[model samples]
Target: MAEQTPDSLTSSITSRSTTRRAVVGVGLGAVALATAACSTSAGQQEEKQSQSEVTPLVDTRVAFYGKRQAGIDTPAQAHAVFIALDLCEGTNTQALIRLMRVLTADAAKLCAGEPSLVDQEPELAAVAANLTVTFGFGEKIFDIAAPAAKPQWLKPLPAFDEIDRLEDAWNDGDLLLQLCANDRMTLAHAQRTLLKGARPFVTVRWVQDGFLRAHGSEKPGETPRNLFGQVDGTVNPRQEDGTIDRYVWGENVEGLTPWVPGGTSLVIRRIHMNLDTWDLSDRPAREDAVGRKLSNGAPLTGEHEHDKADLEAVNELGFEVIAPYAHIRRAAPEKDIERILRRPYNYDLPVAAASGISQHGDTAGGISQSGLIFCSYQVDPLAQFVPIQRRLATLDMLNTWTVPIGSAVFALPPGCAPGQYIGQQLFEG
Candidate 1:
């Protein structure tokens, strides 16, 4: 069999009379063609054909260069860590430039399955494992570059009523590096290699880590289920949807905010979840809290996970079926433009007995330090994220079991081209 072009594949599929949809990836010259059929024989034939061409995990690699950062739009990997760092006492523009250049070169090689220039264990880079290294700027970065022109929104998030206690250790930083990969070893090597290069110029501020089911654990496209056992990231924008221009890139005009074209804003919140108390709630109560079923994540008013939530539905008593303060109900946007892309991961940490912590902390009190690194990306968080969060802060029922403990924001720079550093435009544009 010869390699089929997208057009040729669509034409061939029509001959078989099976339904198919093609999603073209920009600049990729490839179409993800999905086929469906009513006949068992046809389905089985397609399944067997797919099994022969399954992509090996280690063989998969994501390019470090593009119009947008790779990890932002790319499918979430199995393992990830978000690291925050602060500049050394005397770090200057020249030192910052050198740091960025080294990271760029190291990331290029590491992402392409080659050892870092100073890699002690070259074999560790053997399995690139779809690894990606994304860089982000905090307010301090701009202060170092040019204090006069920093974006107005590049400041600390305003205090929210829902926030019980925000820990400074995990709250803010001057620089951010989001490292993701299918394998932890591969991710660790990449992180160490880059951090080693930036060590003299910066210090570790905070490290928030999380993960999902590994590759091959389930269907590739299935949304990951969080520790709460609810399906996560169901409504994210597809990378090839072409809607990223409206939702994630501000203005879509070059140098709109200091070479910020294709760049997006990131919100990172450490939401502590009280699972012990959550476990006390029965199945229906848990489902009711989230406005979705515990089994398949379908809305209470619908039968499928993707079914439109019937917010207006009521029962015999005339009470809202989705609940007045259900998380989904409160978080749902009334207008089209109010939506933001959510990319979150579950995090768990044991409370040390040395700290004299207890287990049954309850709702208003703190949990044993386990939570979700609730992260999102938007063109302007001021418009897209703040409003919905403000609403949730007031009366969302899920807030009883979850508390915001850490909060920070970063400016995700546009992607780099070959031989260009991640934030090259910020200095040169």
Candidate 2:
């Protein structure tokens, strides 16, 4: 996700590099100042200012998985890796900070001179170019934190009656770490590097590999294609310069203390598609539900995916061309249709043989868990994202195939300069 500015490319590159270096140089001293300032009541204003000035370590997005196809055997089950992490007992805050620094450094090294983090997965190579590291924890885990220490904005999501399996996954080992990159090879390389160090504090609960299709050059503003042969990320925020403050960071007024000053909030949902049931739907019905051709992501109203959707256009019978409750129609935000940005990836997991399970079947078949690790970043989750998601969860025809199982939220602080650790604000009073 490269930002285009009015400045010449050469100057832009040069300036950005210089700015990055300067940020790294000042980050550590600033962190110390912030910690000290927060300790004294008289220095509260200075602490706030120092905190505000510190940049985020990475621009992260949240990704979650919903266990819709948990028991079903299918082809998409081979790529899943379950991950679980135990909170470090009496862990030093500085240790966590050092871990982030080490991980970020390793990511930079893996990129081979490129500043952007790379994803090792071929399918995700492009999306991974914009490196984002995301993580979250459940509410019960906070009880384990020391009396004066805790992570910020760490809490349990509103429990949904639809799935009960996630409760154990949450309480047993609550933290989830997601590293998004464009190249699978890069992602693999980075993952191995992080694991070398992360193993001490974080444990791999489940690891699922997935891919999201590139927004077609032929179709603009269309839902993205996934490996599962369905369009995903139809209604997402547009990645653009100057729009970050609005789309990623909510306004800092009205009780909301902007967490990541220049960054945005990432909401990720790992939805499992019931491909068996989805495949059972007739082609016509499937096309009708999505309001487009399944083979290609083009809209019914137009031939190409980028063509403007005609929500009100009528069919030959005078019926609305796009069903009123179609996924795209319901997911689109009414006021600012282009406010949300989605960078989705697909995952296919192979199933394992267990009690009463047959040995001869699709090697990829066991529990097909491939689906979208839906990620969106917005300034206002309640205002910009919730409405759209609520509508889809309640009424979109696709819900029959998708279900929400796991969810978590985190308030990402701004990036820190080199030498400074991530999440510096959590320690500040």
Candidate 3:
């Protein structure tokens, strides 16, 4: 080659560099396309596998006709709606009987995955999802239909000035219907069907909707955590051990209400949780308030969730491991008869702008309203549920973060056979 000028030499070098970069860019572009194709294929395959593995929760069913209603002792479903209705003017004994008969038949049909006779949306009832419909009678119900069957315990809970900030809108009702299911669609359908069927005989007083962890999210028999991140309903009576029969069902038990054989009482309290203040507290302080570890809900002195809390256990500084004012300690039943079967559900909703008040009456302004629908079932509310509640209301560190805003008590009659209605025993006995 001839001796090249400086400009020629520079041009030759630049051309070679450009050609090399072009080749590299083409190679990189091909590799990127291949990688993207592989990623897309893998993602599609994973999604398809996931879709195939999911089991639809539609076919499962719980029996509707039995000695006791299904929802009280049945496993707590993921969704629930507690509806309170008042008897319409001029609703008499005959009308009450007719209402119960109609409601019972509708409930039986819904629980069996069939629509109610007046169901407007029959397709929604196709999924059973373990639907259960439980009926309860308020004091007025007994006053109108069966005065002699009225249990003394069927009244509003005693005032707890220390913790209760009762609201009239949620206080009491003449009739109560508890609808629970693993699916929200099923629950909503059941609620609508029941309410529509009874609309002619009653007027809606209030409706409280609540929920727990989705079905199958936790293993069977696992205790659920509340909004405050504490395990709730840990110390409930076990059905398999006959505690339910003795404490809840009260079958042939002496000294208990005669009207409660195979029947029970229900107390529903709307407890608002102040999560804004609770979130400010430290983890140790939170656990101390609840008297259990946040990790697994074990008592401070124990390691397992069900471990009996050593109420007398102390630490190095001679302080109680579980504080004297702790929630679990205050809520513990002093007598075995004081125990009640608790089935609670958490509720959360976007705070309404008009009120600006949180569920706990915290007007400091919050983004959400949240609370627990505290439900307890027993043979007698006065004997079993009230005593423990009084203890908690007297002194519970949790009082700083929780407040009861609504309360009601109802007598839950025993279940009836296929041909009988829910409250037939009480009315016709």
TM-score of each: 0.83, 0.62, 0.86
TM-score: the better of candidates 2 and 3: 3
lDDT of 2 by residue, 1-429 (tens): 232221222243344444544554455546566666554543454445444443221221111111110001111111222234555666554556565566545443433323234334333322223233444333333343332333344444344443312424323244445555433444565466557767776656555455543211112223556754766544333324434335655442343334445434445556666565566678778878878767667788888766778888998899988898787778766775236656555666565562231122122233564566555555545555666776776678877666554444433344444444344444332
User: Per-residue lDDT for 264-331 in model 3, tens only?
Assistant: 88999998888877777899999999899999989998999989999999999999999999989898
Question: Candidate 1 — which residues are off by over 4 angstroms?
Answer: 1-54, 251-259, 351-368
Write one digit per residue (lDDT tens) for candidate 1, span 1-429. 222221232233333322111111221222123333334444555555544444555666787777777777666778889999999988777888999999889988888888988899999997887788988899988888766646677877778965457878789899999988888889889989989988989999999988888754555556788888888777665545655556767543232232267788888988888776777788888888889987887899999888999999999999999999898998888666566778788887765542433244342233456678888887767777887888888878788678888899998888888878887777665
Model 3 weakest lDDT span, ten residues long:
1-10
Better of 1 and 2 by TM-score: 1
Task: Identify the superior model by lDDT, candidate 1 or candidate 3.
Answer: 3
- List candidate 3 stretches off by more than 4 Å: 1-55, 252-255, 354-364
Which candidate should be chosen as best, given TM-score against the real structure? 3
Residue pairs of candidate 3 with colliding backbone atoms = none
